[model samples]
Target: MDSQKKFWRSLWQLRVPNKIKHFMWKACNDALPTKENLHRRHVMDSTTCDLCREHLEDTIHALWLCKDISCVWSSLEWFHQAILVQPANFRELLARFRPCQDEYKVEIFVIAAWCVWNRRNALHFNRVVSLVTSICREAVFRASNVAGVGVIFRDNRGDPIGAMSMPVPFGQSMVEMEALACQRAVQFALEIGLTRVVVIEAFLNGSGQLASFENILGDIRFQAACFQHVEFNYISCACNSVADALAKKASSALVLQEWLEDLPDDIAPLVFREVH
Candidate 1:
């Protein structure tokens, strides 16, 4: 166990992107982007994509531009107009998005993309494929309605802590995304001076799971160890609605995060309305 810890410690010592390195300035919050999660709960398609045998079956091709995937891309008539790219790869595809000046549209893209992928994974595993257009449509709408804030603190655990709400891309780079998350987490950690805390999400684009915090980039290493002792966990969207609602309204309010043990009474209606 000690050796394993050393291995990750070595990675932190190694070189990482400069943009990510700057993330250390953050107070050590724990807001990680969804990590890669192509593995399955239970699907029967060959490990290789049925349509694109060149690569393993995964979300990238299914959502990007496989022949089967092309239909989905072609159908995003409205979104396509927002940015322009004939992506030969994922980098180009994401690059096409310019963080809308207001930052709200970027949130829509991130959250909706997560939902779209969720629906696709469901189809692949449960044989519940629905029209691609419908998925995109719901995603677009939910982008506007879906709400949740990731919470990062410096201590609640016996030691240290950090946490934050996930940020929307504002014509920003992936490195920028990591920095934004790290900044928020660090800010929270600095606020309380504990060793560890929780970073919960109301959304995921398959970046990182709730409890799995590793290699999350930035030269500083993990946020949980910011001071002494920190940890993380996940909550379902239904459970997260509380934070989501608070975050959306709370964002403009002069503070970065607001914590609650459960959904607030007044906001509960907004979540029900959004879902309905």
Candidate 2:
């Protein structure tokens, strides 16, 4: 009981956007109006999932446990690992990501879960079911965009270890830029001997002709193998302001700039906001 209380307090204090925090709180409470809840309220005659009618559409079945959701979560490396533990509820499922020790992981997980829920609603009302890949990818994009500005490095207790800011070289496509940032982050992690990492990026949605996403993905995979474990997540440009600023610096920089155990005056506040 004490641990659960601590978990809730920690969750509320996380630096995620308030909407995401609200969604997670509601999700844990079974208050998102899933079909099962609707049925209980006499608002829905059937409790079947709108996407796959094989089972009742409870919060778990809609976002985490449905057969249709299997493909979506299976495509994500983190969730794939979490399934082995078979969390009995959403909070347990989220706790699986604590090993990453990053609030960003929570952001990604919540965004993905919300995406699944949003898609289910669309199917229920619009009678349209888009590709699950598209939905998941969209979630990744949004998660990245919301985290405005700067690449932040932190310890388990959320203390800053280091930070890097570099601009994408001129004329590089967004895909190329994202791929480059991820590569550099991986290299930095390798240098620091950090075994577990999650690389977040925001690539233009299906944009850029210079390089195929498959090729970029191949490169990311190769670098990821150098770590004990690694994950790549996508977010929107809006969420990536700090990294974007760093990339801008790189663009104008005559050479690479590195900050160790300290941050520039301008970027320090962003880090402070994220932690406190």
Candidate 3:
């Protein structure tokens, strides 16, 4: 286990440069499963998808490919070039997703997924099934015209890191943007050759008691696994503001990928764009 971890750390260090990036890769407190979680997994019921009986009613089928969803894709020509989206479960689907290097594509993918999720919720709560073509068209349009996006990450100081001021086509909830920041932070850590990290997020959904699991973070499972290593903490808005601003910076300039340098002029106008 130690050797395997070492390999991951080296990789992360190569990807990230700052202490905040390291924290994301080095401390993953969210990964720890509690008795409640372990107990629930043991009760997983049989029978595949409620909608699609053939396959397991898991994340991948519901999000990536389903009979009902195909109509949407066909109408919208979503997979125009033929890139398969086959995920066994929701986690797998997210794991398999590689954010498009193309800013436009990336924005589209994120918004599309969120839309799909929202549509699903509407179906569950309001009995509304969205038009597949509509979803696809909206996905493309929203992605391209995204006014801004948010990216969150954490630093060694147990501080939340994020951005929230890029002009995007649509609006992103603070929670959604924070999750993006966490993902990006882990990616940066991976680039600098670090394996483990602690990502501090100020999320109402987070579980934990004042700082421990089962209090603040609501999606402990996601917050934990997304990073190679991670830790979750509840932070005051005052401390979290800096990170949120950073996410806005990254989102504002979707056209440019200014990976490591002073943020480009487009992204710089927003607060907290600097990553050094």
Candidate 4:
């Protein structure tokens, strides 16, 4: 236990943010005030796990030992290895990661742990439970800041041309943003006199949005008709990382900004990866 304490104390030395370190330290010390702890202190009568409702809540159970948490861990590619080396508690879990040289993996674990805790709180207090995939994706999104939209422009021979991304405006749906991004790309193509061009977007397939689906599609089609050759292609978000990064960049924009050569240092690596 003393050795574990040393391990927990060493976590502050990591390059992670102080907020995360504080949360992790609290988790290590069993200081999160889980339902079981609160109930023991007469704060509440029930000690049920808000997510599963089948067991008493504790820091370990709420963060890691629940069935819902198991599902979340199993959803990740690293789950097999993680489970093989599973620890007895959240502190031990974090301790295992402390010696890992890979900062990115450590970041993912930290973010995922935080996500699980947040989801547990939401369910307990607000009666809200998000899907497991959404929770994991949220962790990845927050850890990687990979929530933006990125667009890569290509020439007729499918050669690399240009790429741009802007953050999605607050309160805008992804589908709405997809349509808007494609529209903007088409308008730009027309402006630059590129008569033939293709707009590839992630997650736009004319499903849902019954009322104005066609109207949106019709608008895109109308815009494409103005060009001599235009095509709309749907690709998985994984294949659209650069464009996604750009959209994330745009989400923080007060006004639309164009980047021809001076891509921001943060997103330059993603742009380079896409181009290469």
TM-score per candidate, chains pooled: 0.31, 0.52, 0.34, 0.56
- Give candidate 1 misplaced runs (Cα > 4 Å): 1-167, 170-183, 201-216, 219-222, 250-276
Top candidate by TM-score: 4
Would you list the C-alpha lDDT of every candidate in the order shown?
0.42, 0.67, 0.45, 0.68
lDDT tens digits, residue span 107-157, model 3: 354456556655665664668664555575456545554433344434555
User: Cα deviation of 102 in candidate 3 (Å)?
Assistant: 2.1
Report the lDDT tens digits of candidate 1 across residue range 1-276.
995455334324423333332332111121211122223433343456554456654444544545654544455564566435455543344434533435334434444444455555565568665455444434333444432234433223322132244434232122333334544554565565544444543223335442333344333244445666444444543455434444444433424544433344565465455445
Candidate 4 segments whose C-alpha is farther than 4 A from its true place? 1-6, 127-130, 144-276
Per-residue lDDT value at 264 in model 3? 38
Judged by whole-model lDDT over C-alpha atoms, candidate 1 comes out at: 0.42
> Lowest-scoring 10 consecutive residues by lDDT in candidate 1?
25-34
What tens digits encode model 4's per-residue C-alpha lDDT throughout 170-247?
A: 223445556767767776667666787878875466467534545666777787888887777898656776676677
lDDT of 2 by residue, 120-188 (tens): 888778866656764554454454442112365567675667677654332333455566666677777
